[model samples]
Target chain A: MSNMPTESQHARGQTEPSHGAVRTHVISFAIMIVLTVVAFVMVGAGMAPWIVVPVILALAVIQVGLQLYDFMHLNQRGHSFPAFFITSGALLGLIFIVVLVLWP
Target chain B: MEAQPRLVNAADRMELGLETSTLEGRNKVLGFWVFLGGECALFASLFATYLTLRGQTLNGPTAKELFHLPLVGVATLFLLTSSLTGVLGINAMHQGRRRSLLRWLGVTVLLGLAFLAVQVVEFITYVGEGFGFSTSAFSSAFYALVGFHGGHVAFGVIWISILMLQLKKSGITARKAPKVFIASLYWHFVDVVWVFIFTVVYLMGIMGI
Candidate 1:
């Protein structure tokens, strides 16, 4: 309820993004591309469909986590709600789909 | 004469409407996130449909039979790069660098277009091989999942363009901040969905379907 914008507000304007954050974004992108290529190779290799599904899904989930946490700053103060909602929704979605897939 | 000067200033202030709007900014970000959540559900339904009819390829080319890893790999690279560029767009905006922001956004949009182009070609390749959407449950699921994602990317490109225009007109005031913020969130969400799409639609398809 202050009349003036505070130091925190000023800091937001002055603070520079860290090298680590930038590095993380770059590395994550590289990893996603590499994993995508690997997935393609695995699919091309004629491996059992079961094996490929899990590996590709695992990588995809990893990539999604990186995008949310690293790039989108979903971990920041105001964004916690969206982050929680999105993660919970994804989990619920997976459960719903799995149950349907496995149900007789 | 002095009173007349004050009157003109008041008129100018009225015309400019110096009070910045906050509702559009806040709602746009929150609303877009909500929309993305619904999108997750939408894709979930499509995935379910795909799983249910996974094996019915109608004597057409199945995932293992028709999916080309190299082509999918190329498309994935393009999309992944686009996501990175989207982040750069945000970074530019944060620094109040409009030109840099637009440049990065332009790169992201182009990459998205390229991804869509590749997808169209891929679909054509599949159809050329007699793997039409109606041929079997497998093809149906495949097309449904991929098509849903492709539609999203198309929408996102249009959306970002509008945002760019808004930013140009208004600059990055607090009102515009949320729009850019939400669009970035939407862009990342699109990327997240692609992660799953890559796995379930492309990678898994090649394994056996």
Candidate 2:
């Protein structure tokens, strides 16, 4: 086993002074707000329901993507496996919902 | 990174505790994910109920009449920003910045309170317009979806208040770190739920559902 701390260790690394993370997190928040506003407008404009639902869903998914990739730092080396597992589970759960609720 | 003496010191002290604890960081993470899985099941049941009872308005205002995009827009902002503040709090804890951690957590709780306050106002308004919990299927589903989320915000505020006290007594020691981490994960999960609420409850409601 390597003596060096892995990247997931780095994510959970306490006592480090990496305040730069705050800045990146703030940027992600700003983007999420902007996207949320856009979604609000698109849905409010009396757009076709079919078009609007998918658009808003896509935006919501992207915001979740941002949360995972940017703030959670799921792209870090050792974190990827857990991230993938979580994403797959969420996706499967979503599919189950659609199949059960909306499927013919 | 500048030589991380503080981290080295904390890690040194933490290695002993890490061995003794059954609920260390990784276990906490895995356990919380399992908890989230359970919550998913809960929401699925609610969603099924909502699908069944959505259109039974029983002479009450339907979702199209009751949902105001502008009001919901503000509420979503508050909840989403609170999630951001929780992220900041966790980042502060990771950096061992106790003051920033507490400050951000304070902001998070305050924003959560604001979201709940707005929800209360919305509920009051709707009820005044002849929509009560038992009024119709729409009212029931609306209350269930939105009130369930409101309950989460209430729980989050209480949870973070305890964390604030913990921060005061213990600072961001390794013991407190995992607690803060789990709290923020809960916050994020709440945020994710609101994302769906915004989409299905507000947006779809306004779409004449």
Candidate 3:
């Protein structure tokens, strides 16, 4: 990236600091709210239990991703460590939960 | 060559937590991330334990009986909005808007306090409903996970309060900027935990999953 042409570098600089990028967050917030509503509807609509559960869970994953990537600025540069460590911890937790659930 | 402008007037804009990308600010932020990493592991274990014990109730009120969705839904709105307010505060910090920063942060703090108030009420309601901490395995796990999260939120409130005081007195000096940034991150992390709680514990339980 350092060796990039000045043209691209200038473009990158323009979009970088990104306080103006908050519009993305507003949009993300909208999507998250919609997703939350959908999740509630899915569960409360009295559909088949199996179908509703996975659908809610899937919407939740999207919301989590949106929160992490946009709201928390995990998608921003210079946050590699925070992103890595956070995901690692979550991964560890998932492994443990799976093991415990499957344990006889 | 990247012109390293060391100390771009620490008294001026403390955006990247410093004028220059000094190792001090970098290390501080890095160290805080490392701390959050450990925090994740800690919370993960709590979550896992909760999941395991969620069904172990010995004739006590099950999750379906105890969880009131509307009340939790309101609490969710508070915390979720606080998370957004926190993002605004952080944006203010980045833009070097001191007054706006304080205003946004103040709003964030207020929302967090409101969330805590609702949580305390919820706990009281649960206890009154006979879902006290020692009532059953499910009760204990529920308290352990959600209660510990509430404890983190409490600590975050105090932490941000002190940071706000420091910011007010010192302005956006490098000495305090990193601290403020980390505290903001901590607040967001707390909200993330709640997202899962709202899902796995509340929504799933509501679905009888």
Kindly report which residue pairs in candidate 1 clash with one another.
Answer: B63-B209
Q: Give lDDT tens digits, candidate 1, residues A1-104.
A: 13123312323333444446557778878887777777777767778877777787787777788888877766544554566667767777887688778871
Which numbered prediction scores highest in DockQ against the true structure? 2
Any runs in candidate 3 off by more than 4 Å, and if so which?
Answer: A1-19, B1-20
Model 3: per-residue lDDT, tens digit, B1-209? 66443222222223333312334555677787788778778887887898888988897889887887888888888888888888777777766788888998888888889989999999999899888999998899999999999999989888888878888888886556677777877888888788888888988887767
lDDT (Cα, 0-100) at B34 in candidate 2: 62
- Poorly placed runs, candidate 1 (over 4 Å): A1-20, A46-51, B1-24
lDDT of model 2 at residue A60?
88
lDDT of 1 by residue, B1-209 (tens): 34664233333222111111233443466567677777777778788787777877777777778888778777877888889999877777766678888889889999999999999999998899898888887887788888988998999899898988987888877667677777777878888888787777767766665
Residues A1-104, model 2: lDDT tens digits:
13224523533433353667788889999999998998889877889988888888899888877876765555543343446556666766676667667752
What's the DockQ for every one of the candidates? 0.28, 0.31, 0.29
Q: Which candidate wins on lDDT?
A: 3
**Ordered list by lDDT, greatest first:** 3, 2, 1
